[model samples]
Target: MSRTLFIIDVQNDFTEGGALGVEGGAAVAAGITEYLAEHGEAYDLVVASRDWHHADDDNGGHFATDAAPDFVTTWPKHCMAGTPGAEYHPALDTSRVDVHIRKGQGVPAYSIFEGTDDAGASIGEVLTQHGITDVDVVGIATDYCVRASALDALEHGQHVRVLRDLVAGVAPESSEAALAELGHAGAAIVESGALPTAGAGAPEDGDGEAGTAGDRA
Candidate 1:
């Protein structure tokens, strides 16, 4: 069974000091870059996703046009297409990414599943085409895009694991809630360190030791 590394939204807008910055966002980006640098060969494929929204439009009400905006459903503009905010964080080594998926063209698309690769291939299509049965997810804003991507992966029938150390969230409470939801939905939450070496324990999060991300329960 082949495995895929799903890097979600490590974009500039999601990192610290950016428009929609999270506290640990920059750390997550650098951590993921370092992880891939060392363990790039651990997975069969590496797919990265970004929020490439339209600059002019409201993005189907995803962005808040009024003064008072609901942070949950509506947000201040960020990650607009062709902008620096939409690009991956400078720390993230995108050269290692096998496929890049851009989502949120003119709508609210949080999941990487919403995006399509350079060849117009969707995430699900690429996974199926490559025979990817297991997926490990990592990136910024765990409570939002990362959470959405992981849940969708489980729904798509892929064995899903979220690497906690490689993810940063908007809020600690929401991030914890998201992880709980993922666990309840059958997605394993694990630390990146628990990923398997050659022929050792399989690269699955469920079998890892205590204190890993899956033990959040």
Candidate 2:
């Protein structure tokens, strides 16, 4: 189907017990792993993105420096570069991920499209290089990164499907509203269970450990 799976910010900082931990975030990570175990080959590519903010400064004012975070435009310090909070969640099996995307380097970013690969290719560029016409979106903070990434995918002219069950949001109400917005914007909100078999399948453990960041996309 010339498709790709987008794994949004499923990092420690956004999961339970981190800087900006959300409810059910850890479950989403583990659920994605289980789904991939059975349907990893359902698509041609799998890409994962993480927030890798700079720890030195306020990250272009994304992180509230001296004042309390308002949680809307500004937030508490999180996902610092090279820290554990920036790494993928422990339960997510990143072994199958082919391209590792890191966003929010020194600025505020929500969409995966705003990030670049280690090779400096944007997500859209990578998808075009691979001829990706379809994408399945899943991950943490359904109302934020997941929502933004799905919208950008649509703007990129790719058919987008958001795996609802594989995502966790900052708040239930906001998450529902985000899904509605995505649907209205032309994204298909679907459950992962209803998807057809996919993936070309990659070797286990990748170039890194089974769940380590060495080869995580």
Candidate 3:
């Protein structure tokens, strides 16, 4: 019955004025902060992920070079390692985070499952160690990382819920499509206020399959 709050890629590079800024990305960050502040005690763990891509060379072909980015499979350089853009948005109060996961170090990674913690523990290991069974997904880029993470959570056999109000996306049409996909995949598309019920710990699922979400993210 233990639950985890997954804050996915709410970094500077994804917010307004960032390298890949979404329309309401900043608002999403602020709203997530407010949600955590009001319901911080409901979860057994709070995990936050960031796109910490490598600065040297393209990240496993994630960054487009020598040409314009098509914004589909390849994108402009962003969220490089050790850069301000790689840092979480200021509005997100990371003090609530129990696990810090960093992904896309030298590769294209979309789901938080592709990430590892500061100590190099895989996300599945972290979740299992905490005995989490339910997860609430929230963060930026609804059509990308947030979608990937939620799908992965569901794939891992966990009860997954996406906090629709706490997320932003790269495009409206694609975002709506992603939400529909998640709903079809067994995830509950919920508002931020839908908290996990109070309970003890239990075993959970594992990593997810990267679909078009991974390709774009």
TM-score of each: 0.93, 0.90, 0.89
Question: Relative to the true structure, how large is the alpha-carbon lDDT of every model?
Answer: 0.85, 0.85, 0.83
Angstrom error at residue 54, model 2: 0.4
Full-model lDDT, candidate 3 = 0.83
Q: Name the top TM-score candidate.
A: 1
Candidate order, lDDT descending:
2, 1, 3
Candidate 2: clashing pairs of residues: 41-198, 41-199, 42-198, 42-199, 43-198, 43-199, 99-217, 100-217
Q: Write the per-residue lDDT of candidate 2 for residues 31-90, one digit (tens) a residue.
A: 999999889877789999999999999988999988999998899999999999999999
The window of 10 residues in a row where model 1 has the poorest summed lDDT is: 208-217
Clashes of each: 0, 8, 2
Poorly placed runs, candidate 2 (over 4 Å): 199-217
> Over the stretch 1-217, how does candidate 3's per-residue lDDT look in tens digits?
8889999999999999999998888888898888887778878899999999989889999999978999987999999999999999998898989999999988999999999999999999998898999998888789889988998998888988777777888987798889889877877776654443343222232223212332122
Cα lDDT, model 3, residue 86: 90
- Candidate 1: Cα lDDT at 73: 91
Off by over 4 Å in 3: 194-217
